[model samples]
Target: MNSTKIPALSENTNLRYANFIALYFAEGLHMGMLFVGIPAWLAMQGKTPTEIGAFAVACSLPWTFKFVAAPLMDRYAYLPMGRKRPWVIGAQLGLTASFVALAFVPEPLQNLDILNIAAFVASFCGALQDAATDGMAVDVLEDHQQARANGFMGGARMIGSSLALAIGSWILNVHGFTAAILAISAMIGLMTFVPILLREQPEEKILPWTAGNASIQNQTLQVTNWSIILKSLYSLFRLRDSMLVAALMFVSMGSYNYFETLLPLFAVKITGWTNTLYSQAFATADLIGGIAGLLIGGYLIERFGKKRMIGIYFFLIMVITSTLILSKTLWENSTFLYGFIITYRWLNAFAKIGVYAIAMQCCSKKVSASQFTFYMTLGSLGSMAGATLIGPMKENFSWDLTFFLFVVLLAFAWLIMYVINIQKLTTQITNFEEVEPADKMNSLLPNF
Candidate 1:
């Protein structure tokens, strides 16, 4: 295998953090607003649950195929233009344009196709940008820094998501859908400047476009062809521990997605909360709890290994998710309901950060984008499955039963963790080397 050394950490830690945080924040805004704003807007327009699910599915469907774009993100880069920055800028531009066009769509409820299609385009762009960002994160961060960075990245994501949920829902509620879309469009457009300011060189050096290191640029592009990409991906699956991580991917966030999809509707029915109130709950609870989780989870990972943290988070999630069913029983006590929501979201974010910390370890720098995204794509599939099923399950079996079933799924994921020793797997993965295609072919011959 080619020795593609991981890039050294950028000298300016603050600037690097800003770049990752800003991109993740934008990504969170794009997803959170769409999920919160569009669904609430449609529900207010008297759209059925199925239609709301369809809208979310339309937005999320692109993420399922995000793996398809990951290889290109790993390969093909206009070096002078900035290796990953170009993809980030282009994707951001596409999302901004899509949001802008969404503002002009007439009677969005009636013209659902227009809204769905625009959302689809925006999602596609966001997925590509996400792949680039994850790749950049993997490239820059050392193995030891993974937990802390994941904490910050995950926290920033929730912050952005919460901000979008609160602001977008309020705008949709007070002003209207067009205003909400335009507001989001403006936010995305403004964020594009963050990446623009992120030059590859330090203050004294000239930009890469002029006198950048050609050798490094060429090395970045060396693994561009289909044969290499395929072989690398195939090699990824060959890891002894890949199967366990893959299974964890499918079930890790399933319960969170399931509840997140139905929570708005559930709030309306059970707590008699409006869109504005729901968004406020999400913003306050998620922001405060998510930040807390990031801080706590980061520290915990430093003290106890990620495997232990994962086990702890899994137990917490099972407990927390199971308790959400009690929201119905506590409907009259708004304080209790809010408290439950906050705790549930807190534990959920904590658990997910644990997942992110581990997933970062699963990646190989050679195909960081494709490999990391391959795991994320599986996670997204889990989320999509949860989104697709929760509504129908709640409708048929009732909310309490649905929550119970989701907790069971979480428990099952927890069991998988126990069965395979993640710490051992991670160690093995760290030591494993990717065999070159030629080496593999030669090994296939019968020895004399």
Candidate 2:
């Protein structure tokens, strides 16, 4: 009779997941814009490859450094609203404003310096929003729920990206840049209301001046000191599984970023396709892949585990990508090109959920936000590196050789991942519990 109360947020888990998914969809919309839509538009406008690649670097730069901001959310929140909610809301509003700011940058896409500044600022807000969103998931979700939540969130982001690429590209093609951007900004602004209306815990404030109070459960879990976070992080990272997983983050999955970034150029500039046509194809591919990630990936992860599932997916990716080299004569066929893009995006389920589930598992209760964010940033850093190298790589190498190199990197990353022992990681979690005295444990955040 006494155990009926929900321990997390005093709300149904499905509602909580749905709210988070909506926010992630917003995040995805902008990410697709920056990473794909903007670059494709630039290519359409006759921007040099160098300038387009440079802009991508500027936009992607913020993600690699978002770990610096993660601790801020972890350490302090407007607790009455929720531990992570204030940062999420603030960052969301900032994201909306930044897009408005970006739309009014006063020059066309070729104005590299001005455009880069606007892009960087928007991306910074995005990074902050991502940090806060991630913290909320860690705070509210049970260990068992992380994989599916990650899959669902990843799917939502992809779907949002699909819409942005498709709809944003159409608007850009017909009405020009400002209209397209403002529309996207409006969509993002509208979704901000989800977090505004939903409470992280029962009785927590929805707004600053509202009547609600902070949850007592949230208070007990508050992180109290900077040094303790650092100490806890060191203890967790020193484990072999942690070290290996960190390296895997730094290498595996970034190939998707490299290929995805290059596709806009490949489709628009090389294949003589209209930017709108390229975006529509990419969007449809994203939709198919997004749906697959949302449903099929989670089910497989439940059966085969993250390690085995990622390995299988990565192997399939290698096989499919190889067909690109073998089918050189059919390169100009729109059907073949679209099929490759769709297949590759589907295989990207490894990036969407498997690695994320493992990283969330690596997060200790005391430094969940910081540790989890750092792991995520490591992967972003790898992605940035891959995106940065493409312009030069394309210039120096044949297309087939370039793909071979990409596959080589993924192969090496998979080999490293194969050595990781998930069984040993649970022991580390248990050992941490034993090492911290019960009284000291009470002084720090616990997983909700």
Candidate 3:
């Protein structure tokens, strides 16, 4: 697209703001239902632990491959609606329909065939929505607006996840699994209106997929289909200290995903709590932790700097993860279980905020979206790895041993962060002359 033809905020600031908010809300609710709510609901239906893990893997697989489709969204602008809006709208509609279909599907946990198919469909649509929404957010927002946008998007995601887990769990507990599914689907459908109300600004020209523009076409090509994807992969590796950054990304995200995927199942196995109670506990912890982490992360980054905060956060996470796993082995009572889970979630929330914020801070302006997407995709490896590891660990070792293994993973993560001296790296990169003014300004803001 002719970048200059992109609409200026000065012409329609109010409309743009309104659209951003609507889009934010729609995307947030969609994510909450698809990610947290639906999976938790499936677990409630007596699905096997392995099945739950598989579903988590399925849902996140799209994010892992987002780098593939990101290019197309970047290159091709929908003529009338706008560059990113059409995909956003279409994905939302598809997600809504998928949720509605899920509402009609019979108890998936009870029927393996039906559950697998439904889960696959839901995950596919959810992944599409995630990629489109992410691209739209990047395409529309100005550089200065990114931090605020991040905060708004992160907050919405937190709120939506909390509500989905809490409310979905409650509905399932009080009524039945069917009712919960239908309710979530209806909510997803209702969110469709938000995108409809938003207006899109037209682009002057479109970039077509071709061999001639290989150098500039990082965002539009699918990794699976396009050879250019391979070139971008190599470019990513060639970045200064790219290996350290990649390791940090893997450990940070992998640790978080591993715990997240297994938590509900862990609750069921150890505590014997119903879905409602489990959701309530999980939501409560996440809400409190997320809010606190956001506040503290902002303050610490502003006061102590990204690297210092990252170091502190990584250490804290290691200690906390170890404590949580050890606590599982040491204390088996109901009261202790409740306390342990709560504390673990809270600490995890804090660590997550710090880790993610620092990671974003590390991105160069030229490749911010691409790098961010790539990090997330690589981080997803941790989830898959965790799933793979958990299966084997549970088969041979005790639950306590598996939890301890998680602690070991966190420690390994800590060691990687320590060796990289991420804080020092942050300072070194920030000193680079080529860093854009806009990016420097964003670097000063609260990220995660």
**lDDT (0 to 1) per candidate:** 0.73, 0.80, 0.59
Residue pairs whose backbone atoms clash in candidate 1: none
For model 3, the local distance difference test gives 0.59
Write model 2 residue lDDT over 144-236, tens digit each, in one string.
Answer: 777888888888899899889889988999998999999999999999988877778877876788677888878766777887666677666
Off by over 4 Å in 3: 1-65, 79-83, 105-118, 136-151, 169-182, 189-233, 258-277, 293-304, 322-330, 358-370, 391-408, 415-448
lDDT of 1 by residue, 348-384 (tens): 7777777776777777666778888988888877887
Candidate 2: residue 72 Cα off by (Å):
1.5
- When sorted by TM-score, best at the front, the candidate numbers are 2, 1, 3
1 versus 3: better TM-score goes to: 1
- What CA root-mean-square deviation does each model show from the true structure? 5.3, 4.9, 8.1
User: In candidate 2, residue 388 scores what lDDT?
Assistant: 81
Specify the highest-TM-score model's number: 2
lDDT of 1 at 176: 88
Better of 1 and 3 by lDDT: 1
